[model samples]
Target: MDNVISVRDLRVLDGKKTLVGPVTFELAPGTTTGLCGPSGAGKSTVLRALVDLLPHGLTRDGHLEVQGRPIRYGKGDSGLRSKVVLVPQTPVVFGGSILDNAVFGLRHLVRASREDLRGRVEQALKEAGLWKEVHNRLDTPAQSLSAGQRQRLCLARALALEPAALLLDEPTSALDERSRDTVEESVAALRGSRTVLLVSHDPAQVERLCCRTVRLEHPETMALTSTAA
Candidate 1:
């Protein structure tokens, strides 16, 4: 399989402090790789760097390539983000119907007729394992769904974009046990068809859902300098 994302010597800095990295890994197409580490190990920070979504005052240095093409940072690369989408930990629901939230990102990212848009949303919802639960209530308010459902809705929104790779940040961390299982099934179903980089602190979850795992550790000492290699 081809690598959808490659990172070498990736590091995140907050002002003069080294908060994360000098980490390296590759995400192959149609595979799920877990980014596992303890809190403050910069797993989430690494995900942010992939999409150039690093928090304010934080800067990153590394060689980041997506789909074998070098990503030019500081270019406001929304297009790159569309291709390798990031679904963050918290499930965010906008003020709208379930259908509206599902197609929220798709409508702006792709141009299509209303029927076509609905079809895409339906497909994404099914892929997210939410169709059977929400299909009859697409027109209902999005806020009415449970937390796990909301997260899957977010997943569906990202899936609708048809991204080459998905950066799932602790997808089940915020969910209850039952909800976690449901979400896990959704992620497991994508094993051979989607390229995924899943960041989690749960080793069992990683072992169950990921084909391979990349372990990250907290830096023992801050490095003042970094190399792209």
Candidate 2:
């Protein structure tokens, strides 16, 4: 299968000190790959690096490509990010109705008529496993949703972009068991259709959701980093 994203010798540095990477991995099309490691292993940092969203004062070095195209640090990062959506650990909902939140990013990124946009949002909602619950309440305030529902709402918002790949950062970590199950079901549904890179501390969750796994660790006196599957 073709890879949606590939990284070779990727690393983040803070004024000459290695903070993350010197590791490599590939996300294949339509496959869910789990990124797991102990705390402080830079799992989240790796995700940000993929999209060129590395924090201030952190610089990346390596070969990074998306859909076979090289991703320069500042050049076209926004475009690359739009194509590969990232859903952070915390769900962020802007002030608007549920429908507004779902269509927020879409309106700026996708050019379509109102009717067409609505159609796309509806499909995305269903894909994110949120359609049935919010179908009639789309006009309602988005802030009214519970934590679980808000997370799903965020998922739907990302799905609306019809991205080539998804970078999920601890997607179920903030939810209760029941809510986690629901989110897991939604992710499982994307297995054969969407390429996903899931970051999680829970071995069981990774085992359940990922077809392959990449383990990252602190380099600790090593000159190079390696990834294991």
Clashes of each: 0, 0
Question: What value does the lDDT take at residue 158 in candidate 1?
Answer: 97
- Every candidate's lDDT: 0.87, 0.87
Can you give the lDDT of residue 173 in candidate 1?
Answer: 91
lDDT of candidate 2 at residue 58, scale 0 to 100: 92
Best of the candidates, TM-score:
2
The residue pairs that clash in candidate 1, if any, are none
Off by over 4 Å in 2: 220-229
lDDT of 2 by residue, 1-229 (tens): 6689888888889989989877888888888998888899999998998877888999888898889988876565667768888999999999989999999989998889999989989999999999999999899999999888888889998998989899999998999999999999999899989999999999888888888888888743222222332
lDDT for model 1, please: 0.87
lDDT of 2 at 156: 91
TM-score of 1: 0.93
For model 1, residues 85-195, the per-residue Cα lDDT tens digits are: 999999989998999999999888898999999999999999999999999889999999999999999999999999989999999998999999999999999888899
